[model samples]
Target: MIRSTLFFALALTSFSALSQSTLQDSTHIDLQPVSVKVYFAPQSLMSITSSTQVVGPKTLTAQGSQTLVSALNTVPGIRMEERSPGSYRLAMRGSLIRSPFGIRNTKIYVDDFALTDAGGNTYLNLLDPLGIQSIHVLKGPDGSLFGANSGGVIRIQPKGFDALENQVQLQVTGGSYGLFQEQLSVQRKVSDRYQFSFDHSFLRSDGYRENTALNKKTLQTSHQWQVSKIQQLRLFALYTDLKYNTPGGLTLSQYEANPRAARPAAGKIPGAAEQQAGIYNKTLFGGLSNALQLTESLSHHIALYGSYTDFKNPFITNFEKRIERNLGVRTYFSYAKPEAAMPWQMQLGYEGALGWNKIDNYDNLAGVAGKQQAMDNLDNRQWNLFYRAQVELLKNWNLEGSLGLNKNSIHYKQRFPEVNNPTGDIKFDAVWMPRMATSYQLNRLMALRASIAKGYSAPTLAEVRSSNRSINTDLAAERGTNYEIGYKFKTANNRFIADLAAYTYTMKDGIVRALDENGAEFFSNAGEMKQRGLELGTWLTLLEPRNFGFVRELTVQAALAYNHYRFGDYRVANKDYSKNKITAVPDWVNTNVVHLEFPQKLTLHLFHNYTSSLPLDDGNTVFAKKYNVLQAKLNWNTTLTKNTAINLFFGADNIFNEKYSLGNDINAFGGRYFNAAPMRNYYAGVRFDLK
Candidate 1:
């Protein structure tokens, strides 16, 4: 099977090159640098004082990745892992200690709307890359603008809304393990002042392991209206329905015996397959944003958003269901004067959210609900106010400062098993965070920057009222201060670009996850932990398009990360774990991409990813070994007519067929921690566009 797949890829590559060479004339494509827009401010990448990265549409289209992890692995200081077809987890700067199944400690936004809820949980997996135009990532903690996060911030912009043109697109893809997907999109400009777009997608996959199938569908619509010359309104709506089966983790012995088998029944508990454990979720989200120019030097922006979620899960132990509703509002004002002797900018913002949840649990009688076990009602609220100021101190130097106040509170009430009436309310003290940064431009091609910021992360609703049918009212919010310095450089001809950053952070009241004997998950506060890391990214153009024999353009991009994370002070069951390596954090991670473009609109991309060994438990007695994977993709684009185009692509992953675990269950009982990733996979896709 592997040989046949390789042969097919080679044949397609050869055919694309031959056809391109015969059909098109030799023409040079312009290679120019682009500017980055961070926090609604547009500037050159080399001039930005913060550590950030941008992934553009060209890269996304060339790679044709199915998940965000595949497209974002090129960014330094970021890690994404998938346990199953639809389960995703992300970590930044070695902050995965608190995250086990979803995105936490990170703020996420789409356009002007927030994707994170009041309880600090972000549903990033609900978005499909087909509708995304670009992604901007801020590397370290920045609680000045974004609220209550220790990791960082991510902003995603949709395609049609930014293009402002009339177009239609269709795409289809099929790959190994019964993977298939279809997408359709339409955008139209009704008038000079109004624009609208709609997108729909369907995806399904029969995963590598038993009971690991997935089905997902999504619909999204967006509209923009220029009310007047200096006023505008934007609206967005989204709907997603997803279902995915879960294959529980296996012990090392089980993994070696059969990596494809589901978790087996043990003692009084049933097996994962027997219980038909899986997740079913239906969600709807919408937002409205408005911007007004109060004066030549002042502007105001406001956004109102809401979301609803219906979630159902059938597990080995119980059948759980939840109905969740959330509403939020965000407003900000900015004043800028660039014409003055010393340019200055200032901003003030307020953000607030309210959430309500109704949860019910019942006995899982072979995937069917039996007797009612428990019922609960939860209410969560969060609010934050922030202020920022920036000034040009000298011709080549700048200074920035920011401050924020954050408040969080949660209330819980139990309805079932009311005899004892387990009810509680917890409120955290308001926190004040401050940040300062400075940048000095050494000529036009190079810059030096440094920053210090305070960070805070509150426990999620799931962590407080856990799946183990227990409420942890004593859990406290984690606090930390991060220090960082960075250097950025670019050549005058834009042939080379490089960025390097070093940072350290010490956190108190850290949260960690653990599994009980029956495989139930719970969280506890680890006393303290310290993290230090270095990140480096570089892009070099070895050769530009010319009369080169067959290669039109050749470029190489690479990112490297080095992490040193350890427990500063921690103890469990009278045993000290101080100085032990942090769980699930690798010592080193590196990624490289090589791009080669041919004359006939044909391109080839080679990718390499490497990760060092990491500990799986707090005791540091078990570890996951290191692994390396190589992948390649080939793409060809043909302009059939003046207004129509077609694209063909093929790719292969895990070309070496190495067996490794992509995600692990931390501190699991009975040593059932391994979840094996797929060995080797191949995919092919095609796209059609009309204008």
Candidate 2:
């Protein structure tokens, strides 16, 4: 009763504030200094050569997904695969291919933090929907801004400024699969050069399947102080704590039986070598960041970031419990000037990680986690440099170019009886990725654009994961080149925008997973791969934000994409395998959203998402059926007093409950996919503010 009452009162306060507060329009048709201040790097977005997209924070709020990756699905030409309940694989512009378990071809960044996975893929462990301010995707060799990313990059920007001169906001949510969340934020800035703010949240989920539950907590703080009459410094820090369970991958047959099912084979380790087992996982990660400015146009930024991560499963399918650990660091730099027509900003950085991995084999027959051996240890290091310049050429024409260089070093020590060989090596390779693009602004509302670049990815330790339990690393770096042409049209003053781009890429030396000499699946650098596609996306505002009338405020967005994959010759098991669609990649991915605001504090939203069927694995032998999802929501605000108002909102996912699944267990051993999508679910929430 107490909790409910507190929430009721809190909701009223926030609702009242919302009623009187003003909502900014991101669609304002002006390229003013204030408008550009928000983007960490605006040049990257305005230039045609880089091929970039920025998903506004308001859009994220409307979607209400738990993670940013979930919202990115609406972006065209980017492919995302749900490797696990909380884990996903991202590939941009046909660059995603087979990579080690912990590594990915694309790099992910949060401000100055590296945040990449232990295996090299960007880590989503700390991602939360409400904490983000905006998301930017850089396609093709972004070596100029982010280091070591050959395919592309995902950049997450956290919310900086908040409404209310001084206030406290709190919220709680409960949903399907025993999911629950608690969020709190305290901020104030009445006077310039003297202000502070903080936000924190806790989240937990029972999960959709066995052993998939998760509990997470995060906190962020920012403080600004004037050091001198003309200089100021801002300091910030962020922390994330996560504890969860991994149920392990399921077979096609097993998945078909139930989406929430778990393998009976993983319990061995905890049971003294039982085949099927599970474990609770824990992780602690955070970073310390800073920004300094002597003048409005001349400022400096720096960050020191690190993370301690461990995954422990003492008992399971192959053998018993296996533990892996990793810790790493990242550093960054930035520079920009608005006065110069050819504004430029360059960044340099590095990351180093030391990890430990060990496993055992109980019953080597089924290859179900049955291995026991102490592999020596692993030490990994990487370094990178990138630069990009936005040059305003002739009238209404702009050009941007970027370049990057990166290298890696790794070492592995043998610990078990069958694998006593230890090895280490340093690989020095420079990647040259440049994007030359130009946009011809025909008028205040129209423009033409085009650009091209190259990309490359290095092999990871897991690719060579050959031991008694798992496979060893034995693959080389994969490299490719990208080609794209596009056009942009905007209404006078930039109130409405539409973008279309067509891209094609040819790549060789693709690194992929395949059965090696041991007849076990592992990473291998293969022959060649290709992908071509077209992307059409648009954004429009029918009415300004917070408008109090039917159609007084509304925004609509839509996109359509088509990707084609071609291969000269494909071979699996030394036999010819060619001309097959690349696995897990959909031929079509599309989405549309409509948001409406009305008088008396009423809002309605409708959204739809669609994706073509995808393959279970790289071979494309097994596939997931195509499907579309629809959702609708309604919110009402009521003012109880001058300082308070109440808002009630309700929504549902998969309105039809149309049963589907992305699971592919059928193609395995000549089988078929068993489950594809989770069952339908409902959601409701209330948020409160105090001052």
Candidate 3:
């Protein structure tokens, strides 16, 4: 009761301040009138490509999300996985294969930085959510913009300078459950011809699990200059430093005892007296890109980026020591002109990445080093091409299509100090993958889209080329094809937008079973399977613009999906294997949200989500229970002085305290498991933003 009273007191104080705040005149970011219409971008946001969706910063902030998994859960046809602190495993378009390390199937990037595996099954930590301006999720055959590994592509864009403006802002926030975050940003117009901008954020969370902790810091910058009336030059750079603790998985009994508990120390036995015995992991990466615009009718963008990843599990003797580096480049060109049939535009591009990996394995007993085990040195390279054109068929009709081709190569060199194995020396192999898609618009308010494309995932360095004791070289790249159709509609006031889509994905000669027999798992023709689904979504303003309406602003939105899957032809026991239902494909998933704004300074929000039961695996093993979660929050903006303003927030997640998991891997090792979700909790914060 006392805690509640204190909380409300703070809310009331801030509410009063917000009512009298004078900063509203200077607090806007986009420089548009509060009453102006705003619509999310296509190709970047929803169903234009059929099973994909885009999330913008405004939506993110209104949701008041804390983790990537939670932030993305509001989307349809997308599944988010949070196995441990700062680690994620995302499966899209019905993909369910696990790689030797880090995430599998889905490709994740932040400003073109490939957060590949550093140690075992690793990737980049989710950066500060408050600093993000938008995210694009490309589903099925986005290889045209991404690569062939592109079952799905997640892209992020930070805030940037607009057509006009020089603005600077800084914000700091502190909340419950040991949460803290701060962001600083600057955007300056050198002239009508030049602009500069930069953003940085720092965040920390103690987390619900005892050992599930996260710490992250990030920096992003952009520079643009107009060298000629029709030409422009742009430069981009980013840096991230993250450290997190890996909470070893637990058995059902252990979970029942404590869901928010981890191995006393990563991999340490219980009742064994020890200090600071846990697996500590950290990663750092940086990148840069440059783009140039040519004539008004022709523009080309070229980018070069690099990343370095390193990780160690010193506590686990004989565990491989790993280090990797990747360098890549990309170029894109676009042209637009009037034609007899209609106005048309063309786009073409290509990108490549080269990666180097090193791993050292040593023999050891009982956490004590013994003899040298295995050493590996390898290189990985990739290249791809993209082409597309869009044309207006009539005043209200439009057509667009694209094609993409990608190639991947891997090479290995091994030098054992004491032992030598047969299989020759210094070898290499390359694989090629291709894809394509097209769409047609019926009118300015509606469109029809369809796509059929191919994609592939090459064997990672740890899978094909690493000499680590558990490295597997007998595996082949996973191959698959994707198909989809979609429709979209929007309101002229930009207050409402809706989309519907359907898709099917099939994987032939799929790659499965990893690290078995000490990473000696051999590849087979494997099984052919298919996943089919439908997604429906919408964003709308329940209350019209105050300038032309009778009430305050109210926004309501929802996303929903339905899915079905089946495993097709394959050899299970040497003979032709037959029918079986694919597992883990939930029949339904939904997200609904409502937000309200009053005349003075208060915003009220509510959100809800639901997911149906799903099988544990492709074989239709055990089924997980269906579940629902609810969240609500209130934000008050106020000022205590002419120059000082205070913003306060109060929120709760999973208000019903539902217990569920998004991704669980029980067969990982010795009857252990990872959960998909955590229990609910309460949170509140105070924010101070200034010039």
Return the TM-score for each candidate structure: 0.94, 0.82, 0.81
Best by lDDT: 1
Model 3, backbone clash pairs (residues 3+ apart or across chains), number: 12
Q: 523-581 in candidate 1: lDDT tens per residue?
A: 99998989899998877655556655688777667778889999998999899999999
What is the C-alpha lDDT profile of model 2 across 437-553, one tens digit per residue?
667767655667776777676666555553224444546676677777887766543445667888777766666654332222455555677878888766655456544445656
Residue-by-residue lDDT tens digits, candidate 3, 1-691? 2322332243334434444544223222221111211111124232143455667665677655456665576677676655655566566655444443345566666554454432113363535665566676666645555565646666665555335346555666665557777777777788887887787878777766665566777787767677776555656665666655545555566666777766433343331012221233444455555445566577766666666666544223344466777777767787877555587778788777777777666653433445667776666767777777766666544466666676666565555554563233222234344444455656555767777766666655554543235334556566677777788766444445667888887876565442232212233335676667888776665454353333365666677778776667755666553455555557777777767777557888877777777755444545566778777888889976665567788877778788876556522334344453556766676665443
**Superior candidate under lDDT, 1 versus 3:** 1
Greater TM-score among 1 and 2 belongs to 1
User: Model 2, residue 232: what's the lDDT?
Assistant: 53
Q: Give the whole-model CA lDDT for all candidates, comma-separated.
A: 0.83, 0.58, 0.58
lDDT of 2 at 280: 35
Candidate 1: C-alpha RMSD after superposition = 5.0
List all candidate RMSDs to the true structure: 5.0, 8.0, 7.5
Candidate whose TM-score is highest: 1
